[model samples]
Target: MTFLNRQIHFTAAPKRKVLVGFILFLFLSFVIIFVEPFDTDQYHSDHKILVLSGFGILIFFVFVIYSSFENLWYLKFRKVWLVSHEIASTILFFVVAGSVLYLYNGLMINQGSYSITSHLLYLKNIVLLMIPVFAPVMLYLRQQFGERIVPLPINSVLLTGENKNEVLSLEKGNLLFIKAFENYVEIHFLDEQDQVVSRTFRQTLSNVYQQIPFLEKCHRSYLVNMTTAKEIIGNSQSAKISFIHGEKTIPLSKTYYKQIKNRLVQK
Candidate 1:
């Protein structure tokens, strides 16, 4: 996606969710200052409203940064990456928020710098207050944007080749064709943008078919997604298959040519 498009569509959650989260955080900061439940050595009760309002503004900025990171970068990976990303982001969120609050607290008290011990205590308090508020919100976000709601194809066909250590996932309904490459296979499929992309796996075509039964064998060296097959040329003995949006012509072997023709006609 282009930078402009990515910025426009940053989060998978509806705009309502983001708006709700922003409002909740803003109100929560206001309440925390007003309640004065925690130790407030930094400011007197008179400045509580002002100090916490500053905190609220900081939270808003941090939230936007976190959302941009999610929208621009983190959306590409699967759940495995998301799990680690969430943990790291949580730490980063707290660190940035805590640092900003520390600077604000120092400036408020007319001190150029605050003691590390006092700042740590303040940070601890912030974390304690934020955990309860953010946990449920994060859970709701995961439910909205996660695999539970949107099924990604990567979860379906996880193919690993014997020659390569890396494992590749094929998204469902995007795979168009597979061409054999000796002991490996080169997969040609459509990406999220419906653009053609290729990935080479160190696995045999036969092994792939065992896992993915939907792919029909067209030639000894080629496996075609019959659903994408658009035209057939010549007879069963010697024929060629053309696919929609597929540039290369796949050989229609005599062995499977009849079956492919019949399937194409039926489909």
Candidate 2:
């Protein structure tokens, strides 16, 4: 269960999906032509190529549809793709594509005279053949083209305000602290020249905090980047935070003193 829940790289690239479909079509056609699987050898030589092409086409369409749906589900929910998702989708592809191909064989080639037992047997054979080809190709494509989910580094953060075009992009290491005043918050950070600078954005502290959760909340109105903090001064009852780059000190509320102290100790 734990292994299935592990996140994996995934891709919804249209070109890659189409390439996969094309590869499967070619592979299936080649196998059917050379191996003469099932009732292929019994078909008339004149119509054999056309009939075999239809089987490949069916597989291609099914693969495209399956991949498109998977891509759509990912876009809609924005969920991380996991091992379980990959496994389930693979099983679904085998069942759906295998069943369709079996029915196609029966109707087009066998004159629709296949029994239930024969259908199951055909499906089983199709699945067995597909497993060796499909699984490795998908794994290779995913490794080559799939996108991994990764968090934005602290050095590259874009702070946006409620007003249009109000934004600040800076390294979190240079950020000192944020001070809240009702609907506005002041972001203090060091400039490239090592000077303390402040920017006022028309956004509440809560909203800003949501954007950068790594910032530690020391008081009701302040969110400090602990990376810039030099040390905690004064006692627990009246604690204050001193920064390495600025003369100003942030007040530490009793509500968050212990938690902040523990975090600072860990740092």
Candidate 3:
């Protein structure tokens, strides 16, 4: 249960998911042609390639559709995906894809005479055989093409102080972190010359966060721009956020440690 609850990185891009599906199609086709795991010998030699290619095509479509829907679900909910979600999806894929393959084999290969018992047995065999191949390929592809940075929706943000006139316009990427001092919040960001600079504003940290929701509240008095965060150093009890271009480190409270860690994993 603990392992399943552990947070893991997820690949949500449609293009990358399609790419993975295409690669899996080629791999399945290759396995059918050479490995002959699915009783390819029963079919006529001349039509073997065509018949086996059908299996790969079905797999490709199922993977693309399933993965795309999963991505859509995540996007709709805006929730953090965990290891349990990955495991559940994998199991669901096996059942869904296996049923499709079983139907294809029965109607096309067995002339609608394939029995349910046989389908069950073959499904078991296929699952066992695929666990080794599918797991590694998916893992490798995700690691290679996973989303590494959080994209900014806008170029710049206008942060206003208590007085409407006290406003600071900053590039989304240049902003580093915000620190609260009593009633005033200090904004730290990079300038045009790529130098660290600070500006003081009469605003509450909470108000600043509402204006720039992308900034992560790592501490009660601090909100860090996770996009600029290079890495998090330290453990669950206490952690520090290091920026990509700045020496400044933001204190990560124990309360937000897990949340910050999950965000970094997505990165």
Q: Total clashing residue pairs per candidate?
A: 0, 0, 0
Better of 1 and 2 by TM-score: 2
Worst window of 10 by summed lDDT in candidate 2: 72-81
Q: Write the per-residue lDDT of candidate 2 for residues 1-267, one digit (tens) a residue.
A: 999988787767878777878877887788787777765677785778888888789888998788888886665444478888888878887888888888898877767786888878987876667678667876676556777665456477778899998889888788899999978999999999999999999999998998888898999999999888888899878999999997989899999999888888988
Model 3, 23-86: lDDT tens digits are 8889888988788775676678567788889988998899889988888655543445667777
Candidate 1: segments with Cα more than 4 A from true spot: 1-17, 40-42, 45-48, 78-85, 109-118, 137-149, 154-267
RMSD to true structure for each model, in Å? 13.7, 8.4, 14.1
Q: Which candidate would rank higher by TM-score, 2 or 3?
A: 2
lDDT of every predicted structure (CA atoms): 0.68, 0.83, 0.83
Runs in model 3 with CA error above 4 Å? 76-79, 148-267
Candidate 3 Cα deviation (angstroms), residue 212: 11
Q: Judged by TM-score, which candidate is best?
A: 2
TM-score for each of the candidates: 0.46, 0.54, 0.53
lDDT of 1 by residue, 127-235 (tens): 6566677656655654454432233444366666776475766665677888997787988888878888888877888988976778899898998888777888888
